[model samples]
Target chain A: MHELPILRSIVGVALRHAVEAGASRVLAVDVKVGELRGLDAAWIQSYFDFVTEGTPAAGASLRLKESKALFRCRSCGATFPPGPHAGGDVACPHCSSKHVELASGNELLIESIDVV
Target chain B: MAEIRTIDIKEAVLSENAGLADRLRRRLMESGTFLLDVMSSPGAGKTTLLLETIHRLRERGIRTAVIEGDIESTVDAEKMAAAGVKAVQLRTGGACHLDAAMIEAALHELAPGDYDMIAIENVGNLVCPAEFDTGAHRRTMLLSVPEGHDKALKYPLMFTVVDCLVVSKTDYLPGSDFDLAALRAEARRLNPTLTVFEVSARTGDGMQGWCDWVADGIRGVADARDGALDC
Candidate 1:
């Protein structure tokens, strides 16, 4: 949970990777975060800002791609997006069955980092 | 002056974290310590299980240390220390998960040769921990009875990455109307390779299995390191 230390390390690794990949300055870093992972995008961006200091990634923009939690019904093989309604439980829109398996929305992938 | 040249460099943001994780893994292997990452939702008995595990391990003379990750506060670390274990708190300041670099820094604060095992208790979030690998030899996800059975399906990635699935708070089974079999079936379906254990840190139920697995993992790591050294 040490955001600064971890983010600093991540930035360091990312900058190193970028340099090794023939990059000078990173323009942007795109990351995907899933809802179930419970990550706050704003917080991550802030942390990125703090950690990227003095690194090749300094001043680089952090773009977060948020994925929603979706559930696939196991009984009817129906896939549906999670309801926007409040509360955590969501009933299947297709079969109206509670036997749903969650799909997507808990992703943390460094999709792409734009560099020059 | 009119012309300008620009270069396009597309890289992965997590490449750096992944690289560090790989290095940490190698170092852990070399040091004969098997790292275990524990993750779950907030108040899902992560600290309780950790406390009990640390106590049990100490009783058996297995030297262990903990890296407690939280968004803020050293309460968990304090609790672990009170139980007679060397524990350090790594405050995220609000980040959802623990990454390799934070763990690497924490390692510098501890005596490397003092402990035979290391447990990184990640921030109590299922999502980010799944994405960021902290170079642990094994990852374990805890699901408490109050959290419900749909967690595995809801948080598939967390379930998928973990080497073991611990269903904590077994003693509260009578109070909560949880479908244990269904949860197990769903978890197995998602991750067939996952080793499932039911534990109640409060009552000390089904903890032996958990401890045994830990011992076995440590022994396996030690044996591998010894074999490599012998070679």
Candidate 2:
């Protein structure tokens, strides 16, 4: 699955940053995933553990934070979060305009690495 | 417990791949080649549609090439080559999608500057390919009539990421409950700027519009190159 490859990248980034910071061990990797990505954190963590074995980040925990989808209206120029069923209908709440663009909510970032 | 020090590394997980894709896109623009990534579920007529589209493009004196991404077989590549265009096959073995690095390697093999357009038939999966950027100038995907219109709801990311949506297999829409209007509405909700075409590659219906859109892209790349040359 894609999670394995992405987790491998996470582990690689974490270890590299850890080593550069002169840390002896990595404690955890903090990542931010947007809602649109729909990635399961537990699934990614399992893959992270599998790939990080015998590395400095072998036992490091993965901390994933999900960000909600945000849309910016083209007409009213207002940004707002999607409704209850975000995927189904995403219109501007302020102007009720359908001409809205996805401003964020498709992010997959490694924010930081906790090392000691 | 040892003192924990936080190392701030605000980097994207696929930053390396994204960086390579950006560089490859710039290189393609400089070389006057329009790269198109074609994605869809298996058996959605990507090969059929591409063959026909390439034929039309060649008829208009636009050179075309193909890079096929399959999980294992080289069947599609062979077919493209038989149609009289240079085709390269990238067998991913077990991987589900093609990344930027693979495209970069394939470009070296393709010597892509010789062609006006290079289309990548990405591995037939809706999910993974949507996440990876393969340096394509435009990403178009097919949703065959048999796949149902609700597919846009099921695979939202795929719908959102694509530049164009081609509803293939219209020949099968006779008795099927595949609602084209509903699919368009749902897909546009996700991506309002998406260009959509309903075509049946089997009967050659709606193929001209699709080909024209692609030709426009190829001509745009050539125009950009000319503009750069003038500078």
Candidate 3:
């Protein structure tokens, strides 16, 4: 339900390119969503089917690849993933610095599209 | 039969929104307006905080206007009027968040140059509100004591995206189990650049500091404009 707007964006991007390419139909759309984005592939696919009806991306499949979050320690310059911490309870393994910074993994992007 | 083809387009799914937000920012900055998008869950004292901030800013002779975004009803806008401020309500009708387009419309309605500072009170939602950008210079997220400290952990995206984390309802801290240090620690770890503030609308405990921040933002923009004109 929360993915509708994002799904619309995905469909818009795919169809725009597919139409520019003069493609009759879109086969699939591959997206890279970060874990923090909180969008599931299956749910978006089900939503994609309804939102893409009668468009170039009609019946197109939705593919999603999730990215993991990366964190960098601010005090020690150590980089690590969040380990069993809510609000970062653990310290950096390299230097025991608790001051960690999020490096990545909050991406919600479309990587490619399959058109036919 | 048309031959099958593969297209390589690695575009951000929300590029359109991002682009519009950038353009809006440029527009606001050029017009000498400072915009802040305020967000939080329902009952997190957003309106209460806004009322206090606006009243205090007015007392200091700072011109401020508001854009109230809600699912429905103009109750919040009415409250703004009670504070003797100008506010244009953007009723989402049911949308959980206010996007750039909605803000664009509201800005025009408010008209530029009338108010140097503008605050957009986004729909009371912790999730979807963080996803959309309302073309503000900074995004503020409010976390009340009743909301719990673990919110920074349960809702990482919202907490991570905000520029300032305002802990509202601090007047109730004595009765609640909220830990300011632990919560700020996690929030800072998520985004080291984030600024934290503790405030209570009912008691006006930290409103002065929050108001100062707002005033500083407006003054910074105004000073730059003055410098540009001088040259």
Indicate which candidate wins on DockQ. 2
Candidate 3's C-alpha runs over 4 A off are A72-78, A84-101, B1-3, B227-231
Candidate 1, residue A98: how far the Cα is off, in Å: 26
lDDT (Cα, tens digit) per residue for candidate 1, span A28-106: 8776666656566678789998778887788988877778866678778887665443323345677766566656665
Ranking by DockQ: 2, 3, 1
Native-contact recovery for every candidate?
0.13, 0.64, 0.63
Which one wins on TM-score?
2
Model 1 C-alpha RMSD to native: 7.0
Candidate 1, superposed: residue stretches over 4 Å from native: A1-116, B1-13
Return the TM-score for each candidate structure: 0.70, 0.94, 0.92
> Per-residue alpha-carbon lDDT of model 2 for B1-231, expressed as tens digits?
789998899999987888999999999999999999999999999999999998888889989889999999999999988888799899999999999999999998977789999999999999899999999999999999999999977887787789999999999999999888778878877676789999988799999999999999998999999999999
By DockQ thresholds, what CAPRI class is model 3? medium
Tens-place lDDT per residue, model 3, A16-105, is: 998898888899898888888766667878889989998878887788888888888788887788665455355677988767677777
lDDT of 3 by residue, B119-166 (tens): 999999889988888788889999999888988778888977888989
Q: Candidate 1: deviation at residue B213, Å? A: 1.0
Q: Where does candidate 2 chain A have its weakest 10-residue lDDT segment?
A: A81-90
Global lDDT of model 1: 0.79
Q: Write the per-residue lDDT of candidate 1 for residues B1-231, one digit (tens) a residue.
A: 322223333443466777899999888888888888999999899999988998898788889999999999999999888888789899988789988999999999886566779999999987668878899989999999989988876777787678898999999899688988878776755554578899999999999999999888888888888998999
